[model samples]
Target: MSINLQKGQKIDLTKGSGGLSRIMVGLGWDEAQPAPQQSSGGFFGLFKSHSQQQIQDIDCDASAILLNANGKLYGREANDCCVYFGNLTHKSGAIRHQGDNLTGAGEGDDEQIMVDLNRVPADVAKIVFVVNIYDANVRGQHFGMIQNAFIRLVNLENNAEICKFNLSENYYGMTGMVVGEIYRYNREWKFNAIGQPVKEASRLQLLLNMYA
Candidate 1:
């Protein structure tokens, strides 16, 4: 069955009646050309330099991407941003990982985190992805301006969509996080309410407790 989703809404999976086995998480968006900040100046009066890179037409066929379990989240400009893995950690701190994509261009330009159901930690009830637009706020860079972004879950065994979450609109600060619940029932794996991007990682813990 196709999962229904709307931007800025969250779904609670703990209330679902069953458990899910293999879940595939995917991230997608409409690709838009990035505008150049300014034009280049040259000594030659006859020379005119283009300020922005040519934008490509949105590819309807590349709207979805399957995340690899070993994949890592990355920023469009790696030097300008940082990606962290946040969850229930023993150290109670975010673990930073090398970004996988830097240029926010073409298809599959966003970062993705994958979870293998069989390898999930026994104590881990959920996982979250945190995007730090800039290591410091002074730079004035953030992800709030991002558009047409979404997360999806796929059933690996059958290559089907189990659920999806949208992140197109929100008033939350630039620093944001999205979480998905893990549950088991009837010897099968199922996920629920995998929607809405949360502003805090701790909220994931709260949702897990609420549904567990």
Candidate 2:
């Protein structure tokens, strides 16, 4: 059975039940139904007025960063410590992002990142998972228009779900979220569910700045 974690909760991932090396982090979300469009005196508003425009799809980018023991970026360059759509795999081969999901339109996990716990360097201590709205400000999109956001961890060996955290907090104006963390604790790997919202510009830079 999979464990459902609440915000601020923590759980052991490798302290017992043998050692785990391969894992998958799954992040899923759905765009909220669009609000009813105002009628411009047409049949079912089939023809939108020139001033009215359809809502653009929400593009939530899921990314991860490796942090040192002090909770800071471990790599010399930003790309060295982070993995996202542009950089699919890390140089160490310990982490990889499957791909980018242009729209949060499907069911289940919209994005996934694979992690080899054993392959991660000793210097790295924590892996933080985050999601942010791409070009949110200019596109007029935010987490408020998002629904059913969640993050989960699965054992790739057998495809068994370990734990899941649902982001149920009100994030109307928030543009970025620090969803969770996987870190070393007591010589074992553990997960921390963090549903903190970031009201900043919803950019990866805003998240990296937290580590800096």
Candidate 3:
């Protein structure tokens, strides 16, 4: 059985079981269905159904922000350490993004990041996972329109489930979320569930807040 994580929960990545070297971080979500509109009709019109608009294809991107012990980002050669669709792999070959999903339509993981725990640089102390709509403001999208959002860490070595976090809160005006973080603690890596929502214009602004 996997550990079901709640907000503010923390787990040591390298403890309990044997040493964990490789792991996959998977994030998933589905576009929420809009509620039906109500139209006034006859005396029995209360149960009448109004036309429902098709749900727009909202694009949600997953990104990994690699930071050093000082909580600062080092630019990757291609994508400048902000590993995402634009930049799939880091210079160190430690963290690599699977790809981008234009819409959260289907099932399973919409985006995934593979982390070779042993390959991570010594100076690099943290990896922050963030999910944000590509053009939230322009598209008028928010987390409120997202459903079944979750993040899970799996042991790639044997495909054993480590931990999983389901974002069970309703966010109405927030465009992005700092889903979680894996940081170095006592020389061992640990995962923290931080489902903090931010209404930033872009992902860059959210990164700045982590440093601030």
Candidate 4:
């Protein structure tokens, strides 16, 4: 089925076919800043002043996506500011290996986590993806804006768009979190946007609750 997403909306994938035992988790964002550098010192300031140096923006576009597939959780750096895929084991969580390209230029950045339905463990029920903004606070500087970020599930068997979550905007430079579930009855994957604009602390708590 085609997945429809609204700004700041959540979708759950666990209700889907029990067939989806494994899946991938992906994360991506846009970088809207230019490179930064230090400025020359004045005659009165013999040494370069730390205050005069420009701090680089925290680019969330280049962060590693974290997930819990089976009993074990896994993480891997994104290839670009786009799509990535990982193998999910029900017990271990996710086994991420290769990354994909979902830059979202004109087409949009589309990152994904692939799950093999047959490999899921009985105790494991869902998958979570936490979108992290790389270097959020550096030299007391904050990352500016993060918009139009999201996560989705692609059915490897039929090549269908099963579930999705949309994170259209975040004002506080906080991270984004989305959760997906693999249902045992219908054999279909379900997804939901759990928290919009969630901070690092909240995200960590959620992950701990789910995995721990």
Off by over 4 Å in 2: 39-52
What total of clashing residue pairs does each candidate reach?
A: 12, 0, 2, 48
Q: Quick one: best lDDT, which candidate?
A: 2
Tens digits of per-residue lDDT for model 2, 49-147 = 776655567899999988999999988998788999989999999999999999988899999999999999999999999999999887767888889
What TM-score quantifies how close candidate 2 is to the native fold? 0.93
Candidate 2 lDDT (Cα, whole model)? 0.89
Q: Comparing candidate 2 with candidate 4, which one achieves the higher lDDT?
A: 2
How well does candidate 4 match the true structure in TM-score terms?
Answer: 0.54
Question: Taking the tens digit of each residue's C-alpha lDDT, what string does model 3 give over 1-212?
Answer: 68999999999899765889899999999987654445533122222334334434788989888887778875434355578888889888999999999997788889999999889888888998999887877766788888899999999989988999999998777888889999998888899999998877345556545654
Model 1 C-alpha lDDT per residue in residues 1-212, reported as the tens digit of each score = 75666544444432352444445455555433344334463221112356333422222111111112222212223221222333212222222232334334556425544445555433333344333332313322234434566667665567666667665555234333333333444433444343344343222233222222
Any runs in candidate 3 off by more than 4 Å, and if so which? 38-55, 75-78, 201-212
The digit string of per-residue lDDT tens for model 4 on 1-212 reads 75766544445544535545455444445544333434465222222466653344333332223334453443332221112233222233333434434332333444444555455444334444554444343322222344455566666666666656655544454543433333333444455555444455222333334344
Cα RMSD for candidates in order = 11.2, 3.3, 4.7, 8.4
Clashes in model 3: which pairs? 76-80, 76-81
- The candidate, 1 or 2, that scores higher on lDDT is 2
Alpha carbon lDDT of each predicted model: 0.38, 0.89, 0.82, 0.42
Give the clashing residue pairs of candidate 2, or none. Answer: none
TM-score of each: 0.49, 0.93, 0.87, 0.54
Ordered by TM-score, highest first, the candidates read 2, 3, 4, 1
Q: How far is 59's C-alpha from truth in model 4 (Å)? A: 4.3
